[model samples]
Target: MIRFDTVSESTLMVHLADEIDVSMTPLIARLVGQIQADFPEQLIDLLPSYTSILIHFHPDKITERVLRERVQHCYQQWQNKPCSTQGKLIELPVFYHPDVGPDLTALAASQAMSVDEVIALHSGATYTVCAIGFAPGFAFLASVDEAIATPRHAEPRLRVAAGSVGIANQQTAVYPAQSPGGWQIIGNCPKPLFNPHQEPMTPFQVGDQVRFQPIDRQTFHSLGGEIWPHWK
Candidate 1:
């Protein structure tokens, strides 16, 4: 069931589901696309998250009631439309060594597993892009294997390096830029996930698929990946 609520005079939040998962993302994406296509003149922008789509509209262009009607119409149309499960599968190269991932050793110790076993579990599953938030290109990938599932750090680091991969509870993600975060650091991706000058800016979008591949230190450097010494 879809519920509509007003966030502000100019914003409407469309609640698509009560929980977050890969299955709900495609519907959210499609509904967003449909709304944008159908109401280009009235829509200011659309912000998508794990379970909801925040629709910002020009109140002067369209009244609140009219906007809701249009959104409801779009939702009805989406129900009859075929949704695509095929999203771009992005394979990211990650170096799980302690030198790059400071918390790798500690995480292994906490799980009662060796470093190699932890890395294998973390890289074994294919994750779906549930949302893109927390920062630019910072994708929330989900359903980390239970064997390696861990909690966030009690105290977040002041600056998590760009491309750092971390896991918190059932979710995992890469830090696309230097920022404060608490997720347990396990590895770092060599590729830049976000670029302001690029066309898409971020390589990922809602509903994309992601898989992490373990790599060596030499390969990490060869790929132009950098790790801040402060992180070690």
Candidate 2:
């Protein structure tokens, strides 16, 4: 539980001091729904981190006293009530080939592991979609295997391919589209990570769990992989 206090008449923030796991996401979502329904004038801001939910609100919507009372009520409701939200589970297939994982060789050499070993370490682990930022459907992932926690590139790449799977710090994620990034690329997933044309656009939402299953280039092509042979 967070102890929230109004710092100013126009601003309110939540200090979430725990992992932003599935358990807390729906609770916060419910609270936000309640607030939006009750007070449409206020704006809610969420910061990305394992811990902390920050909220900013308008002074005219409600007074500090009223806001405090309301926040407490919402917080209590989250604590006592049971959550009834179910998020979608998605599986993306990756083809770990020389052409796909451009940095595979260098990454494997740095870690003193073979390219196959690196791929196995990455896809074998179940990763949490921490947040969708840095880019659209470009997930901020968590819970990467301890063995493959490689550092970001010293010099960021000018053009990282779309669908490239990469890692940084203790997290690993797939780059939704071709763009410059520093995360170490180890493989590529043919599926569109972020497709605005699709129903929800992004395959994984915040707090959704993502698991990767390995596939060969042929399988990836057969599974409806979209590869822009020439990136421009």
Please give the lDDT score for candidate 2: 0.72
lDDT of 1 at 29: 73
Model 2, span 2-88: residue lDDT tens: 766556666666654455454565565456556668777666543333444455666666576676678687787677678754446
- TM-score (C-alpha, index-matched) for candidate 2: 0.74
What are the RMSDs of all candidates, in order? 2.1, 4.2
Question: lDDT per residue, candidate 1, 76-145, as tens digits?
Answer: 8775677775569999999998777899999899889999999999898999888888898899998799
Total clashes, candidate 2? 2
Model 2 error, position 59 (Å): 6.8
Worst 10 residues of 2 by lDDT: 45-54
- Deviation from native of the Cα of residue 183 in model 1, angstroms: 0.7
Give TM-scores for every candidate, taking all chains together and pairing residue i with residue i: 0.91, 0.74
- Which residue runs does candidate 1 get wrong by more than 4 Å? 74-86
* RMSD (Cα, Å) of model 1: 2.1
